[model samples]
Target: MGIKSALSKPFASFVVKKINKWKYHAVEAQQKVFKTLISSAQDTAFGKDHHFSTIKNYEDFKKQVPVVDYEGLRKYIDRVVEGEENVLWKGKPLYFAKTSGTTSGVKYIPISKESMPEHIKAARNALLTYIHETGRADFVDGKMIFLQGSPEMDKKGGIYFGRLSGIVAHHVPGYLQKNRLPGYDTNCIEDWETKVDAIVEETIHEDMRLISGIPPWCQMYFDRLSAKAGGKKIKDIFQNFNLFVYGGVNYEPYRAKIEETIGRRVDSIETYPASEGFIAYQDSQTEKGLLLLADAGIFYEFIPTEEYFNESPTRLSLGEIELDKNYAIVLNTSAGLWGYSIGDTVKFISKNPYKILVTGRIKHYISAFGEHVIGEEVEYALLTVAKEEGLEVTEFTVAPQVNPEEGELPYHEWFVEFVKAPADMEEFRLKVDQQLQKKNIYYSDLIEGKVLQPLKISMLQPHAFINMMKAEGKLGGQNKVPRLTNDRDLADKLQKYLL
Candidate 1:
């Protein structure tokens, strides 16, 4: 409980051994999972209209089951609401996990009992690995807090769709279920404020150690808790909390301020979870990237990064996957999605297929100046520069901005909100510019031409980024305001508040 002695070198090596062992088995285990998937998918009740039958071999499955995005599932999603029991699964879905849709609006994604266990197992595995890394699993006496979205169920008592947090909430061990936030699995998401407040009020006394949620919401809770505590820092309310588990988007943007506010270097865990599956987790104490859930109840597929924009991408099976290659991740889930590209790209960090670094979202890239900068790329570059320059940046947003001079290339405009003022922004901007170029060759070329001018620093009032998101109806409940936007919509809306 006393920080576990900083995870020594020998202990770190032991943890690495466990990781390698798990990964080695993961490759072989995935084949068995694939075999089971292939067999079950062939059943008329399981496949046919649901698209699982399309998978024969891994290659055949890739060809038959075309990459499906959020838009592709719209029609079938309506079928789910109509109570078509097997539309998105083998049997009746236990609940519908609501996730935000781009054009279709809020969508209720059906969660099958078969896939639910996978979520639970992956989550537990993540926790176990963290414990292994820190050698502190034995000391976890405090309650594990999960800040999830609404858990409203429908006419048949199935969960209404919203966010992954709510969907995964049901998977929390039944033994610990009673100890969670008030009405955690049954309350309306609209009442999140009330529920969260009640949870804070109740748990303020308990030794709540591990807290997990999206950064903004957790920050909101911390802010409110701090205010309620009459300017007491975050440490007072959750006095025992040391580990912060966050997902949904990049954590680097808010890392510095969050640590400062909490008054400690908190152990932060990153997760790559989609409605399709709990894809990966950062198992190592070093916290570089996530280890993919290769043996989860999903058959994985990957398309080379070069093929991402192709009309018909040539897919690669798990067997063919190579390390250090960027691939757009696709999933063939037990819940009936086949060859579904979840729109995220990952680069293998090790030869082990199970470990990867989430590079970026497939569609969430900006290439206006021929610099193919994705969300993760920009995030890494910005974080690296900030760390090097010792700048205390809390939040930032980047968009493609065009300079109106004839024949000039469009450039990136960075909207940075720093917590502490940097003494020399000129040197900091130069460092950032260097990092940007180093990250991607095209971005560097653009910078050299003055196409993308110096990085812009915009000082914002306290909690400015979050407040603006709330004002735009893009905050609260399940909505996560994006840290990086490809277009200028968010930037345009937020320009008035910029310094």
Candidate 2:
């Protein structure tokens, strides 16, 4: 082994131990940061434009600044883009992190010059946690590949002002700049084909040790690697890739497939990254859930799911939040967003105020014939069925499809890709359908034929559905298959590719 590689194991271990030891301090630090932020929001920023600037306590804060969703912030963001003072940041922003939001078409979140420290620090904390756990500063001495968004953008003064990918590509650590994947600075937002080609070409030569991106995008890279290897097993591309870091969405849907495609059990880390902030991350060793970054310049509030969307959500301070309770996340960030609803949900795994499990997207839900189904419900159902049937499910997605010709109401149709096909798929499907119905009372009533017919299942050709997503311009870098589609148009599109 090379000198760097030789020292990696011991270094990585030391880092992990050190981080775990400092967990308490991290939590205390977060408490101080949150206290300061809430004070700042109340005293200076909140409602400064209007005359209502006396939000002192928690209740006052809640009442004064009504829980603002992304839609609520959209108008203000437009003004921010147009240089409206006091709307976004205090002064001129260094750059805008252009991101495609889930519900919003697209948005340019004005990242402040002052708040960049928070971003860098949070990201560095993430690295430090990994390093403290692993004890290796140069664990990734080899090339680092970022499978990110568009590289090409409008250039002024020979400088590119693209998207988030462009910003990171331009400002990445100098020594690691050349280590990034090709077209990291190119505008991936324009031509999908060209972006995919660039990604394919970039990774074809180097040996990648560390890679970061969302699941679908990483899958695209692995697929390209598979093709480039001339049908060589995925490990042939790079058995050396010891670490894989991913965020942006749930990994449960894509976990098994990624493992199969890569031909090895890779070390994976999960992160909670949004335009608001990088919220949490998972330990590479545990691989169970994420460790909430309390030191990341934000105060987190958890509102019980039962009380969510009500007249008032019962908010729990970070110290009081519990394990295993579903809560809609609320944030007060250094980015100048106060009591901003991030449109995501999470459950606590531990009470130390640092670890939690990502439940699902707030908007991503599957309601088949008036039965509301969320990500946690579906994920648990699948996990239970997979365990009971002794089946290894590789990847899956569910959508509600209404088939008028078949005289069927909108029912949940599951696309399952299995590692090994069960001896009796009919039996498997029947059990899954029954289990799903039992878990969801509304679906149970539908299965009883009074409301709707039994749930449907389609076993897809290996990677066929993912390829279909690619064919639809939804599978390049950072693009993902809709795990749960409620829209009729998207459901219809997915139905055509069903096997």
Candidate 3:
């Protein structure tokens, strides 16, 4: 056995044990984190302004700090961007994770020294958890690739600024450095297609075991690899490639396409990593959801998603959250983000260890007809129907069609790119629409009331979603097409690609 592979078993066991110790004491871990964050930043500008020193409990925190998005925190962030120390956190942040914004042009999320390690650790522990559970460590000796952004960074007020993935690229542990691919120069390639091509060429002959990336981007890589190998499955090219590590989005929708490309089912670990923090990881193959990172550098709060936009929404802490309810996640991180709303919604799936399913995005939903369709509902509806109909979908998105022909009422339009045409497209659409109605009561009510017609499916041409993303310059590196959109912007732009 290889030296690295031999040692991986013992190391994985140790890490898993340590993680379990914290997971079992999850409530206390979160409580300690909350207190530490408050006490550590008590003298900072934001802390003083919010009267942090006077705060004694979660109730005091609620009174002192209003839950806010980037816009609400922009004033302090602006000061920090100008190199102001002790503005938000204890000192100037170590890095700024730059991401595209909805209202704002671009956002620089702070990443402090204390908080950065959690990002790396969470990723490592995810793999360790897999190893400990499966007793498989041989993959550690094989090359692994993480499809991600350029590792290039530009200076911003003496704080390194780039994509979160790019910033994280710098912190990969030395031990895995030898087993990682593609080389530095290839990873630095700006264009995603070019990068994928380079990666295929660089790693095609190598012994690759693990592939990690957001699912869509990973699919793109798989496609390119297949093409390069004369339509051979991915496993044919890399026999040892057994594990797939992915984050940013759910892998279920892409599972069929990915496994098809690879020629076999492979083990995968789902993770929930955001620029704000590494939130969770799939700890067991048998588990239904990602294990929530209660002991990480983040103290989590959740507002029932329905009430997220309401005036004075109730913010419930980690210990207070219940199972099966969608909650808009709020963060108070060691990075000095206090009462920060990161826009993602999660539903607790497990209680004691606090495992969660990322249900949807707070900003990415369709409520045009007040039916309030979310990502999870749409995905569930479509996937369930697709499974029943024996259809494979490449990618899809949903938007409300507000206006129709003179006699026609409006309906939710699903733009689907199926792997092949279904035998009865109308039948498939009907089943999916019915499934959607089953998932969302409000949507069902709308259809039943004749306020809206049953949802319609608009089959898309091959690579339609990819082309759209490429056109928008969001082809790779944590960019995901929203499953649901309130406006017709994406849906309208997607019109030209329709079948």
Best by lDDT: 3
Per-model RMSD to reference: 4.3, 3.9, 0.8
Models 1 onward score TM values of 0.87, 0.85, 0.99
Model 2 per-residue lDDT tens digits across residues 1-499: 5565555566556655655664666657656776666544443333474223454545565666667776777776666666655554454456667667657877666565556665655554566567655655553567767667665556332222446655655556564566556643444545665665666676666777787788767776777778877876566776667778788777766777677787888666677777677787775565467877776667777888767768877887677777787888988776666667887889887765367888776667766477767777777777777766656665677787666456556567777767677788777767777777777787787768666655667777776666677677666555655567666655565566556
Residue 300, model 1, lDDT: 84
Show where candidate 3 strays beyond 4 Å.
none
Candidate 1 lDDT, 1-499, residue by residue in tens: 3333343334556645655765777767677878887666565343675455555566566555677776776676567677666555565666667666676576666667788888887776676677766766522555667777665444533435546666666567775565565455334546556666776676666777788888877877777777777888877777777888888777777877787778788787888777778898888777466887776788788899878778987787777788877899988777766667787788887755467888777767777766777777678777897787676776777777765457655557777777776688767767776777787787777778776765555556666777787676666665665556677887787777776
Superposition TM-score, candidate 2 onto the true structure: 0.85
Positional deviation of 23 in candidate 1, in angstroms? 2.8
Of candidates 3 and 1, the better by lDDT? 3
lDDT of 3 by residue, 176-251 (tens): 9999999899999999999999999999999999999999999999999999999999989999999999988889
> Rank order by lDDT, top first?
3, 1, 2
The worst-scoring run of ten residues by lDDT in candidate 2 lies at 43-52
Clashing pairs in 1: 97-161, 98-161, 98-162
lDDT of each: 0.70, 0.67, 0.92
